[model samples]
Target: MKRSVLLLLGILLIVLGVVSIGALKREIRISTNVTVSKSEATSFRVLSSAEQISSWMEGITLQETLVEHPENVGSRYRLTQVDGSEWEATVLDLEDNRRIVMLLTDPRAEIHIEVELFPSPEGTRVQIDTITRGSTVFYRTLMPFAKRSILKSQMRINEHWKRLIETSIESLVGEWSGTDASGSEQLFEFHFDGTADWKVSSSAGEFQLKNLLYRRNTLSQPQQLDLTGFQKGPLAGMTLFGIVDLSRQDTLIYDAAAGKPDDASARPETFSESATVYIRIR
Candidate 1:
């Protein structure tokens, strides 16, 4: 009886050892797919914007770009969490309106994320795959639970994106007129195809913004708006990083920092004294 008991104990020890080794060698992977009722171009514009991302990504307070890239292929950002933790993310690859691969790293683990977009009958199909690897055995042991948590987080983020996109698209399709701080008459025409035109008339000159692409995030209290394209006047290719307030009917409280400020951190926090009030005309 003693000999048989000793053999069973030895077998249990061996099995546990094998299990621990296997877990250590494995990396946690999570993949989720969602379809949103928006075009691929619009979806990419929103996804690539750090401003829109901070609104939909839960717990993220800020995302500051350390390096800027026109196509975002080599951009790097520092993401600050609500709890004050920080993570660094670098863009590994990008294809216009198609695919994006990014790597995020922290003290505990490294995460590789790849997002692929496809045009679907419903709208745009987004596939997100994340692979997380821990730096220590203790962290690795917790990865099984972490995988489930990450999956839930991704799903929730996608829902936020869907709601923001749908709400903004419905609310911002018309002509709006306002007066800027300089007393210039400003006219903005937003089209359903995700394009817009800005015409400003002033004593100095008349300026027109052409080939503009607008993306909005209505998830936050004061909605966020971004306008990117070339300008026909002195500003050239300045992008508008701004906010919109739609609490009152037929009114839009617009405040924006013209051109790319020093960084995303330079975006306006609230309606400044220079805020332009716009009334919907059409």
Candidate 2:
């Protein structure tokens, strides 16, 4: 009887161990596909290296390279956030433009993220899989809640990539020209350096433009073109801001307006009644 009781106790302990281990680990997967070529989609993922994560992630301010690798795998990076928190990540696997896997190590837990790309009928399909593990009991209990947040973060990152692939900077470069409602000839020259020049020929005489800057806003649907400038000459230092709806088509449209200034500057107080359409010249 005593021997049988001891054997039973040992079996119970083994069962408990397996259950505890299972409770400490969790996995989540999400996928999204966009109307972009596989090459474009894959390029976006490759460029999102540890060093360039801050460009897409809102709170990340800096990323430091801890280890360098020729094929990207085995490379380790440290990322610092705006709130002074930091996390360490390592590249676990990389298969050229096909897939990338990263291991993110935080103070509370560790997560393994895998991103895979495949060609699709529409364009490219991207799938993200995340596995989270925690050693402590407290963290294990919070895994359910943590999983929700992790999924949201993953979706946000994927959306950023989709927007970037849709409105790639390369496609926006070159000269674009159009005419306004009043038959004014408008010319915009977008340079590779992110600077643009605007020339408007109207009955009111050509308005000199300065401080032209163009940026693509990835957070919005259909994406957005953010144009900033200043009217030169007597209206020097006057602010010009325009939010243009960006479409992947050949034509882009927007309404340019002069922002109100506290200082004295002879600038237009209101924007044009109709939107101006610009067709790609090159």
**lDDT tens digits, residue span 1-282, model 2:** 999999999998876665565475543344443346534323434444554544434467788888887556788888787998877878787654466677777686777777776656665576666777765666765665566776677677777767666545324555678899999999987654467787889998886464487776556443445555555564355544454653544466666555455522322223456878888654
* Model 1, TM vs. native: 0.54
Cα lDDT of candidate 2 equals: 0.62
Off by over 4 Å in 2: 1-50, 55-58, 168-282
| lDDT, model 1, position 211 | 59
TM-scores, all candidates, are 0.54, 0.47
Clash pairs, candidate 1, are none
Candidate 1 displacement at residue 146 in angstroms: 2.5
Clashes of each: 0, 0
Model 2 TM-score on a 0 to 1 scale: 0.47
Tell me the spans in candidate 1 whose CA falls farther than 4 Å from its real position: 1-25, 53-57, 168-282
